[model samples]
Target: METRYNLKSPAVKRLMKEAAELKDPTDHYHAQPLEDNLFEWHFTVRGPPDSDFDGGVYHGRIVLPPEYPMKPPSIILLTANGRFEVGKKICLSISGHHPETWQPSWSIRTALLAIIGFMPTKGEGAIGSLDYTPEERRALAKKSQDFYCEGCGSLMKEALLPVTSGSASSQADKEAKELARQISFKAEVNSSRKSVAEPADLSGFNHLPSSPEHQQESTTLAFQDTTPNEVSENQTNSASSSQEQHNQPASNNTSMSPRQRRAQQRRVPTSTNFNQVQQPRVNTNHMGSNALILLLVLALAALIFRRIYLANEYIFEL
Candidate 1:
């Protein structure tokens, strides 16, 4: 293997095996890179039938913890319109919320299966999944299968579950799928642990296997920094995008109507430029001179305006 799997790490080994399950490749369940980066992975799953996601293949991302089985993975559904925010963390027992509840014995496949099983549910307090009525869920679920992701720029597809439209889905099938998902995620966790430190520069990067071995050190670094830090290529790209907008000089929109002006202001995105290069400061004497000149000009203008106004008023009164 190009990237060594943590052998002493059983979690990594389990994840390695899970990578093999993707072999049954069909339309329903697919995992792919987020844009050009391999570190981030997206998945498309079929929602359980008789529930809202019955005919849908929801698309979402699986964020591996810097620490695998040691820590649960966080998921965010991008295409499933039934409540969860795009790219928001989907908290389950196997997610970040109940880290203590996650079992190393559990694999990525098992977790994914569990997610499918939960689809028919109302997810009252789930971090990502939403609670909606059958009607609303039906409306969104239909869209889930074909939903395209802007960030991924790809449509997520799912293999329809084989059982009859409303067969008694076995817990075993779900367990198997969850196990596979867990295995894939475990590889990422183990790998990340070995690659600790910030996510190294990706300029020379090619492929990062979703092997359980990789730990999410960069993710941890991102979360740890009270300031949003760009450790990965994606983060840097997003940060740069935001900074570019912020630094852009205001265009000549002064003639725009009030509504358009307010819309323009709201449209301007704000992002904390945590990695801006330093700029040189001007001397204090120059600043002071500029301030004094500006103040004198303002005083003169005010006095002239006041005298003109008084003269006009007196004439009008006469």
Candidate 2:
């Protein structure tokens, strides 16, 4: 193992340390790197108590990546416990399938504990998951003890040490259970939000009115808004026209009969009334005629006086 993997490398060093720490199996779990490969490990985990998988001893494989703690490992169940398919890599938040949720602080022990905590949960149709009934699961739990792996041998029945109360593994189990619960809760919340938001988006499109109906309503509102202004404008125009007619002189009333028209002409000023108003012009013409007659009389008097003077001169000469 030393020659195959560089001991100086962090991944190799970390795995070696974990191997040393877990050399003695706990009552609930046991894991160790294979002699041929430091990156591949074989583990055995006892099922959680008070569940269908209780009393089951299951074996599995853990294949670590070159990145080690920076990346997560892939888990494959070798024993059939009815919750996951045998020999298939199972998806878990602590597994390689969900590296985004894995933390460098988590170790192989944590992964095993998480698996135990998750066994009682519904599979929810995930890859490598199963939804066997309680009766089936309980039957399979009893059968898991005899399951064997070529690499790990027939140690599945006695893979773990006898349970000791108040051991450190019990505390680690509690922490693993809490971590699993948190991961499951977050996944449920995300799914619920997506389910709600999808319908809201679709309903937004479903409730929209058609274009023709929207346009007709807009047109009706536009007419209603302008009606008062149009009516006020028409009233103002009519008032102004009536005021103009009241200020100016009246024209001929075609609606009146001939007698009514004559009566109106007499009552109000007309063209014949304008002739009566020209009486001063006639007086002015009369004054001019009187001045002409005075000039003609003066000329006749001068002519008679000149003829009498001529007659006296002739008598004197005779």
Candidate 3:
């Protein structure tokens, strides 16, 4: 095998050591590289006892890459294990399906251990997985031993028995628990992260609390600003009232000549005149003085005429 590949290549040497170690430490699974091609191997596995797959002997093929030990191998079950499809690549973290998770430290023995250990668990629905009932799986398991591999040139049961003198059931059960623990730990971590990532709802709050002193200050300033406006309004109302009284029609029109009445009509203030008052006008001060004098004279003359009329009426009655 070393003569075909680079005799001193790290990958080739590593596979040779892994093959030797797999024969001694654990014997429930046995593997041998093809005589012609070192990169391809055939494996035989004994199923765990007291499970649906109890007393089962399964055969499979393992195809390693040129960069193997650096790259993971692809595993295909040739026997009808009922947990996986026959003659198809099995999807596992240690298999070629998850190259990112595979480690160089992991060897053929590690993968075989994981495969048989997970037989009793439910299918992950991954590629090559099956969901046969326990009864169907047990029936298939009983017939797995009769399966023969052309490359290995031996029955499945004959290949697995020579490797193990101890109980295959005890070792498989121990590995199964370890694998379950690893899966549970990962699930718990994911649930905790989801809870922490959830967002909080804050749409219910509209107003926030403020200091009492700040509220008092705001009210005081508002009152101060409005006081001048109220004063200006009162002043405007008083000015309007005075203008109305002055513009009122003289009670006795007989007191004023037609020319004077016409002048009064022309001088009567309009909305236009009120708006113009806001503008700066030339000679307005003198005009205002003349108008005041004319009002006083008319008032005095009306009083005199009223008194004379009353005295005349009094004499006529006598």
Top TM-score prediction, candidate number: 2
Model 1 C-alpha RMSD to native: 22.1
Q: In model 1, what lDDT does residue 240 have?
A: 64
Model 1 over residues 152-237: C-alpha lDDT tens digits? 66665533334442323455445545654564465457557646723542222333335544335333433564454434656667
Report the CA-based lDDT of candidate 1 relative to the real structure: 0.58
lDDT of 2 at 104: 93
| Candidate 3: tens digits of C-alpha lDDT, residues 138-188 | 999999988888876968666754444365646566775576456446445
Expressed as tens digits, the lDDT of each residue in 67-163 for candidate 2 is 9999999999998899988989998877898775778988988888889889988898888999999999999999988877889674777788765
- Which 10-residue window in model 2 sums to the lowest lDDT? 268-277
Q: Which ten residues in a row have the lowest lDDT in candidate 3?
A: 200-209
- Those runs of model 2 whose alpha carbons end farther than 4 Å from true positions after fitting are 1-3, 164-173, 186-318
Position 24, candidate 3: lDDT: 43
What local lDDT score does residue 169 receive in model 3, on the 0 to 100 scale?
A: 49
Q: lDDT of all the models against the reference?
A: 0.58, 0.77, 0.71
For model 1, the superposed segments whose C-alpha errors exceed 4 Å read 1-13, 26-28, 32-39, 150-154, 157-318
lDDT of 3 at 273: 36
**Which ranges of candidate 3 are over 4 A from the true structure?**
1-3, 23-27, 162-169, 180-318
Clashing pairs in 3: none
